[model samples]
Target: MENDGSAIALEAHELTKIYRMGAVEVHALRGVDVEFSEGELIVLLGPSGSGKSTLLNILGGLDTPTGGTVTFRGQLLRMDSERALNLYRRDHVGFVFQFYNLIPSLTARENVSLVTEIARNPMSPDEALSIVGLGDRIDHFPAQLSGGEQQRVAIARAIAKRPDLLLCDEPTGALDSKTGVLVLEAILKINRELGTTTALITHNAVIAEIANRVLYFADGRIVETRQNAVQRAPGELAW
Candidate 1:
């Protein structure tokens, strides 16, 4: 279950994805081989329609690959049943998408509590919010909060489950530069404090500087990878 210092927390071997549109087939991913490790933050970068999102979706169990193997924690992810995949996502993975997805009517605390209620071993909503530096905003409704605050609540909700893996697809896409930096700070804090293995999908090259490793995608394949000697803080990143 442990990578033991190996940068292989999650791995895909010859992974591929194909979509059938009538008689025509679209290949979204063309045999990608990659490995991500524990206690590291990784940024998946690519242009629009480059399959970065497709790959992130597959890794997060939102989509299935059509070919090859996916292994997480030494267990085969590709062959998992729906029930198993659901359990995997619930018990081990935390996901944050671009949209906040917070309930319009629910206060931030209530929104976060919804997940902790279902989680097997969860941090209290208060604890999660505090970690995201939103301890004072718990009583605020999404509509009453700023876009960044709502997104922070969304993040608190995801991490409240005490998940081992965090998958973010364009988490900062909806925020302005300053707000995005705040969101990224919370993500970085979680990565540093919990040692969670995290993978982020982003179009911004600046975000890559915050990652222990960066993977650049092009035409459904990884075209490059860069390893940082040390990840920089969100404040240190340049657009």
Candidate 2:
């Protein structure tokens, strides 16, 4: 509801994605059109097969659309070129998934260091971990952390690159409500402090209160979009 004209972070026009299996065609996205403003926090709610994941993949350059166009900062995404997509993903996007894909042997700092080492401009692993409220736990390995802390480590890894866009696919899916809220607080902090455009997908509608806007997806399309005039903190959400 509130757009301060910070510039458009991402735009998708009539985007469609189709998957084929034998004679069956699964339409993942149906000409979806959406925009994510810079520094905005948007939440996506949907059932399974609702196409939110497909949209996220396309936006992050992890997948291409079957038709239409998607762009970042007004630059058309060369979805057809793997090299271009790779560069775009590496330089601009950050992703956090349901699972914490941290290396078992690496400490939290070391896990975050993986991305900072390769990024063009990145914050130190210590700073990244601090942003996620894990500074004191930097010496702990993945095996020593709890589910939510591990997820924060994953978030630290993603944002250490100072990515302009953050795409989260069920980042709290594995944790309980309390733990999930902690993870969300970390996300909220990043979006606010870093001015990162964020898009989050989740099945739990309660989490929607924490977003600036909410998009409901059904049958491969966004059926409703709602704006939160006053955003709620993650701690305020019970489920």
Candidate 3:
């Protein structure tokens, strides 16, 4: 459903996640409320164990909240049904994790093709690669490419399905500063060109400058929220 103030692509209300380890309980999230506006790029920033990843997982349907509701396009997420959640994730969400999970034996094109084959409405593998600036490297195997190039291939695979939401958890975490910036550029390019609602989780605060809004997480809660007057290009960031 749309937010009163803006178009809400997705949102979580009164979210909480608690893990039980015998008698001890750990709260990964605590009564959080957040919304992702359509076509906006929002970043979550916090130290380790601050629940940024937890929140991302919940939003992406990889994990369920202990007490809360996640909604997409005004429909409530079915946390109780694995089948529904799987379909939702398969059809609507694109995820890029810190590591490039490309199959070592597959060329970039083939790697991306795996997703397109299953997607109901997918772009060509080559087209996805082109969007990430990897058009020329489509036939290269992961080992034949640099780390940054491989990461871009991973990103291309994620976007090939033409998902409405792109949830990235440290898409640049394994790269050096220059390479990380390249990955960020690819992500921003998708958001700008395709109008994907994107959310990124990063430990580096400099990355926040590239987002329309930033959520500062601490101890299982969003402690501060900042909205940028102007989004800086990823190439302009250094960390």
Candidate 4:
């Protein structure tokens, strides 16, 4: 892809990751190179075990590539030190996973407050919930809300920190198609409103329609990349 001179939010050069268990080696990534532009929404589509999650983890500073370089806004990310990576993740990245991972005992507002409290600069929990269209449910507990509602709470929690990057790994994997669209809509809103650079991983090919860029992964590599001239709204997406 040709860069039109937009600032790079994140860039990976020849990224590779290998895991070893008792002399057995697993190559999670194989020389993957990619770049994410500032405020761009990207979707990664692939089958399970194709390394989409691994790539997302690396980009979000949750995991280090065994070989390769990852840079954020022109600064090289050093993964040799856990403290550095932890700081990077805490200050720069927000992650949403397949599961909501909400504290069962905490209300929706309280769950998001947990992140805001530790963040350098954060929005009020109520404001964050409202951004995700969950202001009315802020006082509700996880058990009281539906699966889609719970995921919106998770999204609110992530954006509460006001991180520069939002990484979502199958954010809608656990929801029904109708419900998943709601979750995607929340993510889309965050990216559009807050200008957070976003990367999402999903098995559903249809979700790619909403992304500015779509990367198709297979065998730990990005086999194809498609750029959308006009991105679709989350509500316009079917399944």
Q: Give the TM-score of candidate 2.
A: 0.98
- Writing each residue's lDDT as its tens digit, candidate 4 over 165-215 gives 999999999999899999999999999999999999999999999999999
lDDT of 1 by residue, 144-183 (tens): 9999999999999999999888999999999898999999
Structure candidate 1, residue pairs in collision: 9-36
Shift in Å, residue 97, candidate 4: 0.5
**Which of candidates 1 and 3 is the stronger one according to TM-score?**
3
Of 1 and 3, the candidate ranking higher by lDDT: 3
Residue-level lDDT of model 3, residues 213-236, one tens digit each, is 999999999999988989999888
lDDT to native, each model = 0.89, 0.94, 0.94, 0.94
TM-score of candidate 3 versus the correct structure, residues matched by position: 0.97
RMSD, candidate 1, Å: 2.2
- Superposition TM-score, candidate 4 onto the true structure: 0.98
Weakest 10 consecutive residues of candidate 4 by summed lDDT: 1-10
Error (Å) of candidate 2 at residue 185 is 0.3
The TM-scores of all predictions, comma-separated, are: 0.95, 0.98, 0.97, 0.98
lDDT of 2 at 45: 99
